[model samples]
Target chain A: MSLILKGFGKVLKNKEILAPINLTIKVNEIVAIQADMEHMNAFLSLVEGKRSYITNEIMMNEQSLQGCEDLFIYRPDMGEYKRLTPEQCIQFWCDLYKVKINIDNVLALTELTHIRNKKNKHLTFSEKKRLQFARSLVQNTSIFIFQEPTYQLDLQSKQVFNRVLNEILKNGGIVIVFTSSLEEGVRMATKVFRLNSRGLQEVELGDEGEKEAEVKEDETDSLIENDTVYQRKFEKISAKSDDKYILFDPLEIDFVETRERQTILHVNNEEFYSTVSMKEIESKLIPYGFYRCHRSYLVNLQRVREVVVWSKNSYSLTLDKGNEQTVPLSKSRYGELKAFLNW
Target chain B: MNLRLIRVLLLKEIKDLIWNGQVAILFVTSILMILVFFTFNQLEFNLPGHSITMFKGIPTTLSFIVLLVTMYVQGNLMVEEKEQNTERLLGLIKVKYINVFISKAIVTYILSYLLFVLAMVIHGYSFENFITASFFTIPFFLMFLFLGTIIAEASSNTIEVSLYGWPIFIVYFVIEGLIYSSIESRFFYLFPNYHIERGFSLIEHGEFLAVFNYIYVPIIWMFIILFFLKKRRKNSKTILNSGFS
Candidate 1:
């Protein structure tokens, strides 16, 4: 059994947030993805069937997700409940799914049996997450999609989540977790995919040196051309210009700016419109020498040729591009900019 | 249209409504109000020839009680599921939207009617009055349930519902009461409560056709509300359009 997505794409408000992509998650495996909140919303909306995708096909239990009703389950990241006991929550799921569950086994598995009698609103934050985890366990589906499952979880509760994840994997079920933390993704996933506007791209999860050592010496230099994290396979960031699609390398872009809630990528004295938020763009291009010099501007550090001081507290970065394009520099980031440049 | 699925959802709604502390408190307060009305009737107005007409003129009082309790319990139930983010979980289950709506309405109607009957019993009314009140509240509370569900769907939380919904509903309710008792305006007759009161009056005066007038309006209102709600659910941007799960 497996959960599969072929050319899955989500578009909103006349712009595509997720490009058409392909992925396959099999039973007895866990796949984790790191994505921002908007991307998560778009993805979750598609998974829940609120919005349709373009050129997308999803299969669970060897059939389409729509055809196979009992194939997948979804759980939101937050854990506030309406005064339900842990046992009641499990029983409610059982009633909804039309299955008989041993509540004791579920509570024991999630280590929530002790609080089975306590009301949900009375539970602590961590306990509530465990109760949610236990609720998902009651549904016997092939694939489980959890949005930021480790959010607000304490260390001990995270250990409990890991244990529960292992149980699902051992029982031949696929678990897909969406998170923003790279550490959590690396710790939980057998395979990791970083979700961006372009699509899902597989990335290294375990020790960096171990994977590097496994690469052949002749191919190592070509695989990682620079010290930055941008690989050739994951370099192109998708954008649009005049009703046509365009792709720009993050390394080649001088800066990105936002105008009227629209993100515009600036490269080589040209502008391409983008749909992603500035914060999401910043996080994606941060490893490739992009710096958030101001709230509206994200400048490439490698393109910065000079720092112009407009006042005692104000500064701007002059790029090495045509006519030395200037971008605002926030007062708070001035110290980091100076320290990075050693000036 | 699966009966088994509807039954399961109904049972869950009943459980949630009964265990709610606010519902319990309102239930007890309603009983106390009935007792107070009973004690005042016995001690202060226990004169001859005052037995039949007593508590008959103010059927709206009982209607008001039922309205408040149903709105609080049913409306907040819908809003809470949305706020707690549990509606997303329900959407993945692939249950029919009609089943969820039917189950919730049935459960709300049953609980609200039971409490209305209990309050009437404590007030020590005659069988004729009891029968008239029962017939009046059936449509009365059902319309209230529809109104409450609409308000719940339009708002994000219980606080917003009370802040905006209660005033609009109360204004409509009080205006309907005025039109039923004192006004002869045609526009006021559009309020379902006006027709409900007129139906109860016809029942009181042995007009068998009251069934047609009162019954047809709420039935039509029910269909209209359900249609709009179904369209709303279909076009909703979030998964919090239904009350199930």
Candidate 2:
């Protein structure tokens, strides 16, 4: 489970772009790493060097299940295919994606045509974020190491990535997917480690998205039904139709449920602003799939389509419609968004 | 994965060598030349020495040409793998690189050697002294066959193997000629082919002994080439050897 990367640090020139410290991984776990192309390439250099600390043998293999004999088929050309062996699948997604470039008359390949260099061009931010989540998964080789495996790929090829990792884990193979997405990491990982400006923080799988949303709605119903101040604020906020967000002081908030959660209403009014607690509203909204990505807002999962960079310091999302709402995407919550988005 | 697999890979390499259109054509042409020489009992040569029995001329002249062509083919075996990404794929396998390299060399040598044997039999039958010529030639043929294989694999692939390996392989005999011509080195039995070729050539020339001596140079060349391969592997970084991210 422990990969001793000898002299790896010396070669990676830019260290500041790396995740915050305070992370630890165990055997047979999934930890996805999401980093820039340069960083991943450096990581690849280490892996190919038999840096895995395994024996010199490195077979490009897939699964070997009894019923699933022809587990994965790799297309080396448009119509040509090569079978994936048992070992390749238990490891990762490289088998399906990479096309091994070779020479015509000899075994030596051109150094210039190396595969790592080829991945650099044409990547969207979302794809890069997705990779960060994948990296975190790969690091979790602590709990589940892939046994003899195979790939079950469909057209477009990426559909089998998660299924393959899951099978490997089912048989017991550790996976670390270095990613930058919250949705991808959360979906694949049992336990996850995320990089925050506060340092490395770990998040336990809290609850299912639908169930959590339902719970929050029930809390909001109770607070609006019972509390005198909350009812007045709700009335006042409901009266003010056009205001996007109501300013509520934190000290005035009365959280009857989950401790650290906060709520920000999209209405500005004195009555509702004074009576309704941020935490109470958040707790109430939880049942509706509203999770706090920042201190000031509770985002509805169904409404959010994408987190696009608005500027250097902030990002905005064009929700379900043309609703252009800018929200602060913090480094602490960066990994979470990726997992939540499932990208 | 096992000895059986290794044997299969070895046989496959030999099959590849034997089936190659270029190698086959070169081999066939060498035999045809030998057949032509035997038909005329000798080609019109003004360079040196008498036009003795064509049976005697083959082990030297025809063997050198075939050895050169075979080595040329051997040197390019890995080139195709590099071009096709086969080496990277095969490198992932549990097999040893040395095993693959040696297997290819052995296969190339065997094919070249077999071609030489074919030419010998063809020439012997034409001369009407097949029994006597065949008797003296088999042992020498075996020795040269093994040596020719070694030399082909022994040289560096930077320049073409045929250009470098063949000339150097044949030069060992030419050096023997320079020494054998001198009274100072009348006891030139050191060259494996020198004595065998000379032994038969004195009474009646036969090219078999000279071909046998030609094999020694290549045998020594194989060991030398193996040494260089060992040095390269030893010097490279582990990252340099296999996967590079």
Candidate 3:
């Protein structure tokens, strides 16, 4: 099934809030749209048929979306009954949809089985989000729309969300995520689009060949002085965990940072002390999409998700690893990084 | 129209009411008000025939309790749903808004009826009259439910519910006073509480036809309040709309 939007746009009080958006989403396809909060809310309102738009229409599988809203399950950022337990919340959704799904399975899928009996008000921020996800899962709708699915969530909760998304795709359901974070959009969806006053535009993530060519160009200039050029082989960075030396592929490392004069390698969610200095490691991993974002921080460019700007002088790089690791970005390096990314 | 969905929605409403401490307090207060009114009726008076009979005072007491229970309970339910945004969630799940309305109304009606029966038993009223009173008071119960819905739709939270609800409730008694006084105005007939009082007085006199005559007024008020509810529901904005604006 394909969901198509034909020139969907909104104008409030003669002021353009959202530009016309034309797009098509198909079954088993996950789409993420990145926009500022104002445009995001307006776009979501237009899609949910809550706000009247000046132009365009939405159709799902050749049928108008006006009366077929049941086919869409929208999980807003926050809207669960605080008094109800996770199990009760899921059961309520199941009964409302008039479907008999396995409540236990849903609870398990959301990793909420342990807290199934606890009231939602008592749940932590991540658990409440999981409860909301479970509620959406039980509806068994063909289209799932989530707003900031992983906002302020822990690593485990993000993993649970990833599994839930896979389950929906495996069931042949279409998923659309609307987020203000570009990193979240790229991390959660296969096809990511940026929406703003300019209209909807697809963000082209370069192919493997293009990335390899860029890396090769950088490597050629640096290696020209070496008389004996050796064929590249699989390389791994070595770090010491207690007395044992562990070898990790460069791609496995989220970032490298020096703490108290000790170079540390962060992989997954674990920290390992690297015997090599930060400068040496940075030079070796440069061909593998690594960037020295800060004086003491070498971040894997492939794992960098967001460049968060707190103020004119304060900036940070959020990594796409578990728990969303962040490293400080020096002001001097910020311009170079931006220019490299062509942003 | 979906019975299963309605049942589920009813169960949710019942659970919500049970967990809400404020509603529980109001419920307990209603019971206490009945007992207090009953005690006042039993005490002897110095003036002969000046003492009120339990039968005569119970209907008035029950009417006030019905107004309190139905309006507070129904209004609390709707406002809480709107405040917490579960109403939007239910809409997303495609649960018909009418089913939710029916569920909340049923719960409020049941609570009001229970309070009425309890008040009758405390005052030693007969079961025959209990059935008659309950049947005749159907329109008033519905009127209160619709009024509660209107108050909730107009407010965003419990604080606002009381802001809008209590004044309208106090006005019911004020209208009742005007109906009993020398004031001869047709506007007093427009209030449902006025018709409710007239119908109760007719029932006391065993004038069933006159009771039916007053019944049409409250019934008309019910329809009018229902129209307002429909209009409010149609124009009600979702939480996202608030963010957009």
The 0-to-1 C-alpha lDDT of every candidate, in the order given, reads 0.69, 0.41, 0.75
Write candidate 3's Cα lDDT for A120-227 as tens digits.
Answer: 889998898888777667775777888778777876787788788888888888888987765566556767788888899986433453356446645765675375
Backbone atom clashes (below 3 Å) for every candidate: 0, 128, 0
Using TM-score as the measure, the top candidate is 3
Which window of ten consecutive residues has the lowest lDDT sum in model 1 chain A?
A209-218
Fill in the DockQ of model 1: 0.32
Ranking by TM-score: 3, 1, 2
Candidate number achieving the greatest DockQ relative to the actual structure: 3
**Highest lDDT model number:** 3
Estimate, for each residue in A91-146, the C-alpha lDDT of model 1 and write its tens digit.
Answer: 88888888897889989888888888887878888888888787667777767778
Q: How many backbone clashes does candidate 3 have?
A: 0
Show the lowest summed lDDT stretch of 10 residues, model 1 chain B.
Answer: B50-59
DockQ for all models, in order? Answer: 0.32, 0.03, 0.46
* Cα deviation of A170, candidate 1, in Å: 1.3
- Chain A (alone) TM-scores for all candidate structures: 0.59, 0.36, 0.64
Regarding TM-score, does 1 or 3 come out ahead? Answer: 3
How well does candidate 1 score on lDDT at residue B190? 63
Q: List the candidate 3 regions with Cα displacement exceeding 4 Å.
A: A11-16, A50-57, A60-75, A206-343, B1-4, B48-56, B175-198, B201-210, B238-245
Residues B35-89, candidate 1: write the lDDT tens digits: 6655554554546755333333334545556566676667777677677777656
lDDT for each residue of candidate 3 in B1-245, tens digit (9 for 90 to 100): 66887799899877766678877887889998888878876876566746534423565676677668898888888788788878777665456666777898899899888888898787665665666678888887888898888888888898898788778777766766667566888788777666766776776666766677877887887888888877777787743122100
